[model samples]
Target: MKLPKRPKQHILETASYKLFSSKIPDEWIIRDITERDYGIDCYLEMVNDDNELSGDLALIQLKSKDEIEWTNKDTFTHYGVDISTTNYWYQFPIPVFIFIGDISNQKLYFNSVHYTIKRNFDQFVKQTTFPYKFKKSDLFEGKDGVFAFKFHYYYEKYRQQFENELRFFISNLQHYKDFQQLHNNLDYHLGLEDTDQIFFESMHKNFSFLCTYFNIDNPIPKLRDIKKKSREKFGNESHYELYEHDLTEWMEEYEKLTINLIVGMKSFLNGELPYWLRINPTIYNYVNNIGDDGTLPYE
Candidate 1:
């Protein structure tokens, strides 16, 4: 089944934020993350180790598979607008960064907004290219809007790459046997006995986080529903029927993103963590009158 774009982006971003916040310091905060226009989609605010109010701003531009290849240069711009050309980054305290993750093109690029500021200089030739590693501390200093922009740009870029990888796994709906094999392997690796609840519950939590991030009211679709919808759309056919008359541009994008979401979730279920815990570690440890040996009673 196809997944929607807004929710897919939300899940990916939320997951990354969760991981980053967990791994990183508590003072650094992620705020105002959204699909908002021209403005920065996500912001990081905190007092740096130097005790400065170091803040970062970033814009995220999403590209579908086809758009990834066909998109013009503007697609690479932060917030879908050229800050360097317009010198908008300098207008605000928050620095600007642009992140582009193109799954179809398999390209991930990050560029600083200051590329515009220095582009007119003789030594500015190097600003045109994307950088693999950016120094965050250097950018966070002063009112240097470029640093925050680049920070967000890289963060969203990583977010998009992760979403694409998860989506790829989610799109292969016909591969249940592969999922089963993965499930078995994870169960074995985790030394799990009852795998069903752990498998589904951890997934449920992950999906719930994604849904919350996107503000999606109906995030978790039943697997049976996915199969039903898949049959309706593809049937015995190998490809989806794309008719201009049947769906709007936005609808088509939403459908595809939704499909990706489903596929990604299924892929996530067969991972090691859920299989190890059997989705009931909390119940096993904290709750009394639990079943023997960590396996849930029904499982």
Candidate 2:
């Protein structure tokens, strides 16, 4: 009697666990997420030398195959991902990797679900049946058979390129006099309300992008807190007076914090400052408007 073909999932899981654990025995830990019936199969956490958790996590989805045909040089077709699955993976809090294991060859390849979805959003909307493809080198690589599983490594690479673009933005903003003239021109052409709306919307978009990139919480609640405190402190003050005094001071403080953060990030990129120092809690106080001391609050 011919025996039934054994399910290859167990083999895939074992292979992934062994490959990941052997590479970073001390600094990384992988846990199987058996309870969830959704896209995620496992979660990986990074740890410091002392085995303390480093706050870096990634969700992984595994696919195993005996043979996967290469559709192009350095690329293989990945199929069966529905739109709902793509949407769910896109919203994951941590980075998500789809690892395809060639069970026969014991080779692994991977790609970022976040990037794949972003690249195909327009095509997805058109209901196109495009196969998801990724390059082989996209798999994690490192020295001595060890890999850097920290999501920050990938994020930092993106950030370096982003900073170059940001420099151009800052250079444009440095022309404050020109911007003011343009604002006046807009006010002459557009109504004051329209000008104000456009300016505020631009500011909102830039700050929203910054907050998301830096993993910072939205600052609107903190701004409301400052306004509330001001109202309590100066109960007899007129609304316009409060705006000129409290709101003006808050805006100035926020500007100083933004400048400091940009400068600090540049220094950190140049290896002049430690990563921890660059994103310290004290720096975050700029958003909270908590302290005025010039020195960093943490060692």
lDDT of 1 at 156: 39
How far in Å is the alpha carbon of 72 misplaced in model 2? 4.8
Compared with the true structure, what per-residue lDDT tens digits does model 1 show for residues 1-299? 99756767665545443433343245556566545555455665655567566543333322222223333433322223443433444354434544444433333334454433332332223335322222223222234543444344443334434344444333332242233334432322122233443443344444444443333454345545543554565454533222221122123333344444453333333232332135334322322222223222243
Compared with the true structure, model 2 gives a TM-score of 0.48
Summarize candidate 2's per-residue lDDT along 57-168 as a digit string, tens digits: 7787777677666655968878767767766776665678777766566566667665554445555555555356856665554642234334433554355454544453
Off by over 4 Å in 2: 1-5, 9-17, 20-25, 48-51, 127-130, 144-172, 175-299
Question: TM-score: which candidate is best?
Answer: 2
| Candidate 1 positional error at 194, Å | 81
- Top candidate when judged by lDDT against the true structure: 2
